[model samples]
Target chain A: MSDFPLLEREMNGKPLIYLDNAATTQKPLAVLQSMEQYYRTHNANVHRGVYQIAAEATDLYEAARGKAAAFLQAKGAENIVFTRGTTDGINLVAQGYLASRLQPGDRILLTVAEHHSNLVPWQRVAKQRGAVLRFLPLRPDGTLDLDVAAREITPRTKLIAVAHISNVLGTIHPIRALADLAHAAGAAVVVDAAQSVPHMPVDVQALDCDFLAFSGHKAYGPTGIGILYGKKDLLAQTEPVQYGGEMIDSVELYDSTWKPAPWKFEAGTPPIAEAVGLGAALDFLTELGMDTVHERVQDVTRYAYEKLTQLAGVTLYGPGLNQTRGGLISFNVGSVHPHDVATVLDACGVAVRAGHHCTQPLMRWLGVHATVRASFGVYNTRDDVDVLVQGIQRVQEVFLP
Target chain B: MTPNLSDLYRQVILDHSQHPRNFGSLDGAVAVALKNPACGDEVTLFLDVADGVIQRAAFEGHGCSISMASASMLTELILRRPLEEALHLNREFRRLLQTGQADDPDALGDLEVLVGVKQFPARIKCALLSWNALEQAIEGIDGTGGNPP
Candidate 1:
């Protein structure tokens, strides 16, 4: 069945082989239709509309939250709070939850390979709170050295934030084990699920993480919406960073009383349509089965990895082909710059991301300025990999010829 | 494949990128580094100016073929030209790339190869990196009375 209508389109008179899914997934028709239907039928402000349309809008928005909660296997809908994206979600936890609890001697432990979104907030929080920001070094294979992590995380570590999957390395982190380690050290664990949530099954309960953050657009949903799932007791104790209309129970001139966990976190009119579209995205993934999607992605990634390895002058990063990894590969070809590689690939109608991938620390760690990354989504096939391999060959010919 | 590849990565641009001219630091030169934060394309331009004329121009950095080649060609074109003329050349080259029209062909000789960059809006910044650095370097030097310590 033709699930992806976008794949049918052509670029430069060639079929579009979109391999930049790690940046953002192309939305399926279901997501588009869901958002369209919401705008067409239930177009109203959420939470406070006494009118029927407003109530429907509120219902759809909340229903999306519930679906997101179920998707992450959280305790209930109240555990889910909507934000702009993964960056916003992490900022909420960093500013609202961790900042108040951290002391001068406390440490915020994170991996060296975290996206700038995950790393910068903690840097700011640490600077403000006098907390020490510590990094868990990566192994030679680009996977997290959990042994080093276990050694670094101590009683003084109040919060441990790490990406569930490296956006650059494509190595899936051992979140459950890391969470267990953090909890034993009296540290609350926060999972940056922006890369993991879309490609695999991420059960919050199974992982036992205190907080998890993900963006909807990365998982085939609309932009400008994401979810932050925190534990009920933790969120209840944590104060909201943003204070405005619709989030307070009672507002006095000098003092104010706020609503419960999720609502208190959501200030102002949230992304109602985007949430509805994310709900539809969850439904689409659920029907297709996350396991099926994960397996398909693994196959495509493996194919691309193997194909890239065989090519001369190509240096691949991250885990081995046999090892479990996310559906992407970051690599460099000879001395050709990634921007030039991506431009040549674009000429051949292949879309890829070429830059630091927002992991500048990791880029420095990797000893390269930048690398070309070809990532996969569910719509990708072996044929796409074949085309990408051919495109890389073309890049080599142009640059290395 | 269509000829768009050749249109973008012309052989001359490739030659310059592969073996960039004046591709090192100059001794006792006033240097300024410019970076395209979006793509991590960085260029550190070094200029040896004496008596309002560019004595030597060189750069050292890593970027795409377009950017590296543009930097190489920029140094070659601006060398021995007066400071004002070099700044004027920077403006004319930017205009040509932005408008895709060689309004002043005599001013932009080798830089005209970058006219194809106008077709790719995203690549325009890559083409402009060196010129941007040159502009900043000239302004820095001029602001310091054409001689900076």
Candidate 2:
């Protein structure tokens, strides 16, 4: 699968071994070409122009919405609202949906392993609405403690926001079960599927989540485009947080009416080229099959996990190789700092993420300041893992010896 | 295709990182903690200044070799120097790193070894963490008139 043109290029003279897919995936030629085609042929403002080119632009943009809806297995295009990214999507729910529904004593439940994007928004909303922010604890191995989740999610919980996959730990959370429990308590379930959607099969209906959010860039699509999937009824009830030209139905000097659902949320001219790119990305994944893509990554991750564990002085985080995990592994070598480890790896043309992964609380919980994460994508191969293993050994030789 | 490791992680830098000098808190000293939030590198610098002179300097933290070695070097170089000279050296060292110059060997002494860090832009922050902490501590002293409490 080295068909990706970027993989053929050299970094620091060596072929680049990109193991930072959790940060963002490398776009395929199809995704890039589709985006280029949109700008070169159908370059026009969507939904506003009556001309032929504008009509084609509008059709392509709306068709992207349809593709996104089908990709997530949502009800229809009405359920999919475009946002900047996962952060924007969550902020929409926090401000537009939950802001009014939240009461003074209501609880917003989240797990300890959530990325800052998922955690900080709730903190702001909770503070705004006088709602209490609570956490569902994790087990020793970094998996969520469902028993604690069962007890903590009480009737007072207004919303249960959690990551479908822990970005730092790479452990997949039990979203469907959590959604069921939250639904039983009359609380809406909002999933930060930023990591999960790109790596696995995510059917909103199957998970039974009230709302789901994911980014396009992380799924081998372009930035500035993401999807927020909400139940049609819930979206209709929630107020739009933004107001401007495209979202309006009718306007007066002091009074105005609004369009319905998705359009109402997407204010101003949307990211037309970016939405087209995401549609092409989804199409590419569909052709390859998500299951095949998932299995490919899992194979690479398992190989990396096994290799890293065998090396002395390497402490691996998250679940064991035998357990279920997303396509990543966070680790540290001896007393070598993660930044230094990453630097040494970069010298050998291996790019890994070495930071808190935006999960500082989880870092504190893990008793580490930071970790070096090697995340796999569909294009990764066993040879990439071998190079990563060798690079890590070089780090050990440099720092330890 | 491997990068030249010796240029970045020199023997002296590695040795200083492994056996850091004055790696402890100074009692009754002005202290300030600095953190590189992106990488989680942290250093708490404590300076015992007496009548415009740095009587002692020490630090304690967990970070990479560049940061730890830079902190160790900072403590070693600032001891017994007047507060003004210490502050000046901090600025001079930063300028050297930013400009990638090593001309002032007589003044910079052993600190000149850090000139190699100029090539690696990302590692420059690691090499400057302790100096930042020292600058903050000095500013704290200036603001409080040496009575850090």
Candidate 3:
């Protein structure tokens, strides 16, 4: 508990019960120190200078890439491209990889449960290429309808993009099965692992996804840095979206040759300090063991779901207790807006996210405009859920009265 | 409830949220739709202007108590007032949300209760949603348009 120093703070007059883990996790002391140490000792442009500090800085940056590659069980650092975040990574794939390959009348398969980050990029590419967008529907409980997926993925389908776990519903999709389906149809698979990588073990090779993306901020590291893992062959074939310093192999008067794969994608001075912080975050989680972390969060989330269910007028979205879910729950109190609920809960020192949560289409499909989400992390405990329950009870006393 | 919470959600606020004034569409009224893209809170304001005075004002929307109650109270204060006066009140209301103090407390009337919204920064958008729509409606009329036909 002391590892995360922010938990000691107060909201209103009470101890803060931080449950907005889905939005971003609170950083630990190790990550903070790692970033500070980088600036204090080894602040230099990476892969540029021959000086000692520059060499060490470059080493730290590349080492972070190695850590990220191992974290996702990719082939090597060559398979990992450091990106701004999940949105930037997905946009890279959309513009750099898919833009040239897409032909008129080709189809891109997606699910209705995707975050806007995953949906909007593909929408623009489809529009530009005169391609059609096909959607896979969700079950009543918010799980992906595999039957519909079978019908949607045809020979015309050029790409299949889906989230490994729905950020709104916490429904873990069958990515491996979907990959097999896409492979049979000759369509590439792109998995938005932003919500999955932070909470569970994610092996891109096991999933056999062509491309995978996740953000470091959600995994208790600094913002502005993320990883986009693509198969070595696919990355080699794709062109660099942005070109400049560091990424060029040779510069000529008329034509410049660009570097291979991940370096070509990086383009400029990368996020060095943020990469160091992310590496430290991965080390911190590795020390804890991902399986242990996942178990703790799942237990806490299940306890919260149980407690929330017992309350009358509470409508929980996604699967019930028997079914597996990620470390979050979305629900709404009867006739009470999520904004009001969030405000009242804030006064009681509970922090939860409220609103569309960047999933407006999913909200519309669920016949709701918005929802309140309470998400868990490795640091959350049963006592925090108790405080959240009390806060919600206070909300009922105020709004439902 | 704490005094701050009580001050934020007074009985008057609850009443107005439950029964918003001047709700529904006004026939032959100029309409403007506004959405707080962050939260999906929406407001469609309708105004009937006759000879530089606001003859009628109504709104239709769904949001939290603060936003809905603010919309209801806005229609009550702006109806039958000159366009300039309504715009002045809107400015004063925005000032109250921006800073803790309103220029003239008495000028706000029942809307003065919303002055407590200054404490909660996030809810300030909710309280100002309809007011923003009101501004856009007037600006649309004053810039390139004339009075309601």
Candidate 4:
């Protein structure tokens, strides 16, 4: 609790009860100090200078890549590439890997539960490559319909992109099984782990996904730094989307040679300080242990589900208690708009997300304009859920009359 | 509701939200649909124009209380008014929501209740959703509606 200073602050004259973890988590002291230390003592352009500070900066940056590789349990640091965020990472794969491979009339398989970052890039690639995009529908409880997936992942499918955990519904997909299905069909799988990586244990090796992407800020690291993990062989074959400094091996007037894999992928100066902060954040999570963190958040989520279900006219979306769920719950309070509910909750110092959550297609599929989402993090407790329940009661009191 | 929230969702605003005015489509009316990309709230405004005046105005949409109520009051204020005068009120309504001050308070009528929305920087868009639709609808109007005043 003391490590996260922002949680101790006040909103609307009451202690802040932040429940917007799905958007981004508050940074810890360790991450903050690490970024500060990098700026103060190790600030230098990496990989270029002949001086000592530049070498030290290069070491720190590479060490952070090692941390990210270990965090995702990828094969090695060479398999990891630094990106702006999950969107950037997915776009990289779309253009660098799938765009050139896609053939006319080929298929790209996706789920209705994907975030826009995972969905839009594929749409762009499908359009550019003259390929068709197909969607695997969800069951009523928000889980993927495997029967549909089995039927959809035919030989013609060149790529399958999915969210490991639905951002709005919090329904955890069966990634291992999906990966096997895609592999059997000779299609590559891309996992959007933006929501799952921060909440639970994720092993790229165990999942056997061809590619995976996650943002650092969602895991309590600094923003502007993210990870794109790919199989070494696949990354070796994929082209670099961005071209310029550092990524070049040697250059002539009109033609140039390039470096290999991850180095070639990181074209510019890269997010040096942000990567240092992300390394510290992964270290913080590693020290706490991911299983323990998962258990703690699940406890809070179960308590929230129990309390939120008791309220009359409160409709919870996604999975029920018997299903596998994640660290968040999205719901609507009767006919009271989620925006109104969120605003009233803000008056009570309970901050939650209320919008399409960048999943408008899913919103349309769910027959809703938007939903109010109360997500959990490491520092949240059952007491925070109680305040949220109280704030919701206030919303009913104000709007139901 | 807190004092500040009460100011934002006063009784009149609540009434309009519960039962909006001119809330269905009008036959042969010029229509425009607008959505707040941030929140997914959408409103479709329809205008029946004749000569240079707005014969009728209505909306059909779903959104938060601020958006629904603002749409309801927008219909009531713009009915039977000239296109130019209605556009003026739309501008004034937006000014009130953004700055909490209206140059002509009487010109805004029931829309003035949304003045409290200025305090909620995040929700000003909800209050302005329907007016923005109205602006777009007026733009599509042919010469039957004269130039903006």
- Cα TM-score per model: 0.98, 0.97, 0.98, 0.97
Off by over 4 Å in 2: B1-3, B140-149
lDDT (CA) for every model shown? 0.92, 0.90, 0.92, 0.92
Stretches of candidate 3 exceeding 4 Å from the true structure: B1-3, B143-146
**Tens-digit lDDT track of model 2 for A59-131:** 9999999999999999899999999999999999999999999999999999889999999999999999899
Tell me the tens digit of each residue's lDDT in model 4 across A1-401: 89998888888777899999999999999999999999999999998998999999999999999999999999899999999989999999999999999999999999988899999999999999999999999999999878789998989999999999999999999999999999999999999999989989999999999999999999999999999999999999889999999999999999998999899999989999999999999999999999999999999999999999999999999999998699999999998899999999998999999999999999999999899999999999999999999999999989996
Report the C-alpha displacement of residue A276, candidate 3, in angstroms: 0.6
Q: What is the per-residue lDDT of model 1 for residues A144-199, given as tens digits with 9 covering 90 to 100?
A: 87788889989999999989989989989999999999999899999999999999
Candidate 4 B-chain TM-score: 0.92
For candidate 3, lDDT tens digit of each residue in A159-233? Answer: 999998888899999999999999999999999998889989999999999999999999999999999999999
Off by over 4 Å in 4: B1-3, B139-149
- What value does the lDDT take at residue B131 in candidate 1? 88
Could you give the C-alpha RMSD of every candidate to the true structure, in order shown?
1.4, 1.6, 1.4, 2.0
